[model samples]
Target: MADDETRVDAAEEKPAAPSDSDLFRQSEIAADYVEGLLDILDYDGDIDELVSAGRPVVEVVGGRLQALVGQRGATLEALQELTRLAVFRQTGTPSRLLLDVGGYRANRRKELAAVAKNAVEKVKEHGEAVRLEPMSAFERKCVHDVVNAISGVESESEGVEPSRRIVVRPAD
Candidate 1:
């Protein structure tokens, strides 16, 4: 009887996954926040709010939007965090919101894929670990995905934020 009660209590303590509707609501809130920001900045763009891959995604497509992307997508990352905060304020729950401006993330993903491949090649050739420059969490994930797909090499992140980087090593 005690074991049954404990099992029930543990199940109640586990948080339920957000439904698709909830994810869509987060995207809508994020889109509204981004639209207001674009208006303030006097930037022209079309914002799309949707749920993709179990997460909320807000994409802004427009011309001359490099300013929003900033150096190495720094500005875009900041905007994404702010938008997530806005969604949290309204929904009282944290959101995994992906905000893309001018297709920066897609382009960067391609670039990171190439970089990861090159690092893997070096590791395989020399049989030594290759240390890559520091990158954001998104960038690191991109590299990890690429490296993980390939054989004879493995990847791991080292150090801390803004200084953390991927180290590709020969598979043992």
Candidate 2:
């Protein structure tokens, strides 16, 4: 009986998953932060925030917003971190906030997916490992997902941030 009571207590203590409303709130906070940033930079853009894939995403669409994306998306990554900090300050919780400018990430995802598939094909044909160019965490994750879905090939990241890359090879 004591064990059963303890088990019940543990089950009751488990935290509930965040509701969609909570996710939307986080997105709203992040959007506000991004909007302020765009205003400060004197960049004109339309900002939209919403919850997707269980996380908050803020997208900025405008002509000539490439400056915000920076080279290799470095600036965009930094902005995402800053936006998440803003959300954390408001909600007292760390946020997985995705910030994009001028549809860069959407286009990049499609490109990376193609790159990953090509790498997979190469590994399958050559029976050897193939190293890909350095990519952002999000980019690497896209490749990882694509490679993971395929059989007889595996992908892993090798290096530190800003230089980290994915290596795809035979599963064995």
Candidate 3:
């Protein structure tokens, strides 16, 4: 009887799955944190939060959000890290939240995809390796994805940060 009771107690102690409420709470907390940041910088932007692509995504859209995005999206990446840290502080769990400003990430992603495809074609046509200009980690990821999707070419990142480029070679 004690063994059976122990099994029943263990089942009762199992935690429930995280519901949509849990996800939305994360977004709300993130929005508040970002709002404070904008306030401190005297920046103006509209914050929109929602579940996108199965993850929490927040976008700051406005003219003044440019500084937040920074050159080559460096500031934007930093802001993303700070936001994740804020979320972690509140929830005690790391977040995979995506933050976009002034539609920069969306536009950049499109451009990166094009660059990757072009490199892919070059590798296929010439049967030689193609080296692309250095790109950020996000950009490298986009290129890696495109190359992975293509059949004849493989891509890898070489070099160091701020100069890390993608090398595309024909798959052996």
Candidate 4:
């Protein structure tokens, strides 16, 4: 009986991980808040929330949401932080949140990945460093991951925020 209890305990001891529904709930709450804000501002944008890359992401699409995104997405970044703060206040847990406006983030990430791939090919061909255009931290991270996956090459970021650029070079 003791051995049986031990087996049961071990079986129940799976690694702790949040469920997808829990993550989706966070996105839903964020979307509701964002929708209310849009309504208050008399903005016309469709809000969508979903789980992407294991994190909650909210996307607002419409001409009016452009202001929420701001110049170079500065306003969008600020709004994301504020949304995370609101979520944390309610759930008492910090969130790895992602917010996209007008599909900018999704489109930008795709473009950055392509740029990174091109730089990787250039570095492999010429054995010289390839400097990419300035990108946000999230964009840099995506590039870094893509570059890191390839052998004989590496990527690193230089300069400061809003001006930070990624450089891909040979592994050696």
Candidate 5:
């Protein structure tokens, strides 16, 4: 019909959202960047790139790659940001890319989950707020997700970066 044709024509004038293939391209760029870094560092690792959780993820698995993780994943986090920048430079889009080396993130998530559970327990038992030590944004997010799932308890992030912490308290 004429009306339908008109609508289609008007819609075509507006830019569309990024498609799945565009997102996949971001991962490809990030993977290439990471591979170059690995070559420069003379590190041996297997890289797998994919899109997950609506973001690009680059996973590196190998032995003796603990140095890539740094102390408490600091180096890994920095690497992720750098990869994201590489993606952005090519795509002109900011990315929420995730980079994991040697199962570090998986291990850290399990450990942080335990810490969150402990905080939930303390809040429930004492009916008082329990404050956790300062953590990176990723760590705080993991803790928040765990605590938010439990009933009668809640968690909030306070303070600024490098000093920010989570506080678990009884729900109202």
Candidate 6:
């Protein structure tokens, strides 16, 4: 029937999701961009490009990279945005490329997990909601993951970017 044919045509018109190869390519582009930055800054690092969790990831590992991380990873966040822009310029598509330098993200995630656990414990013991300090999207996600894995507690984010924070409460 014509209806079936029209339905098929509509489905075909939908934009296809980026394949794994496409994500990997984004990582490659981001890696190259980060490498150029390191070169310009006269910094030494080992860059690795890959696709992880359906997103591109560019990790730079090296010594004396504290400046790149900056205070509370502000510089690193800026670099990630710049690297994402570089990928967008080359591929004509926005990128969700995660850029990690000097194992900052990994270390931060561990610290956040501990913080989340503490928040959950406080919420459980007091049977009251506990508000945490404002955190970046990445940090909020890390805390959410830890809180979600533990029972008897729930977490939610409130407010806007650069000021958004998490609130952990006892499960109703």
lDDT of each: 0.95, 0.92, 0.87, 0.87, 0.90, 0.95
Lowest lDDT sum, 10 consecutive residues, model 1, at: 8-17
Q: Estimate each model's TM-score.
A: 0.93, 0.89, 0.82, 0.80, 0.88, 0.91
Segments in model 3 whose C-alpha atoms lie over 4 Å from true places: 1-21, 159-163
Residue-level lDDT of model 5, residues 76-160, one tens digit each, is 9899888898999998888878888999988999999999999999888999999999998889999999999999999899999
Comparing 4 with 6 on TM-score, the higher-scoring candidate is 6
Best by TM-score: 1
- Please estimate how well model 5 matches the true structure, expressed as its whole-model Cα lDDT: 0.90
Q: Model 3, 54-86: lDDT tens per residue?
A: 567788898867888889999999988899899
Give candidate 4's TM-score: 0.80
Q: Considering only N, C-alpha and C atoms within 3 Å, which residue pairs clash in candidate 6? A: none
Lowest summed lDDT window (length 10), candidate 4: 14-23
Tell me which of candidates 1 and 2 scores higher on TM-score. 1
After superposing candidate 1 on the true structure, give the runs of residues whose Cα lies further than 4 Å from its correct spot. Answer: 1-8, 11-13
Model 4 misplaced regions, further than 4 Å: 1-15, 159-163
Note the clash tally of each candidate: 0, 0, 0, 0, 0, 0
lDDT for each residue of candidate 2 in 1-172, tens digit (9 for 90 to 100):
9999999999989576678899899999999888888889898999898999988889999998998999989899989998999999999988888888999999999999999999999998999999999998999999999999999999999999879999999998
- Name the lDDT of candidate 4: 0.87
Give the alpha carbon lDDT tens digit for every residue of 10-72 in model 1.
988968889999999999999999999999999999999999989999999999899999999
What residue runs in model 6 are displaced by over 4 Å at the alpha carbon?
A: 1-14
Q: What lDDT score goes with residue 76 in model 5?
A: 90
Candidates' RMSD to native: 1.9, 2.6, 4.5, 4.7, 4.4, 2.5
Position 110, candidate 4: lDDT: 87
For candidate 3, the 10 contiguous residues with the lowest summed lDDT are 14-23
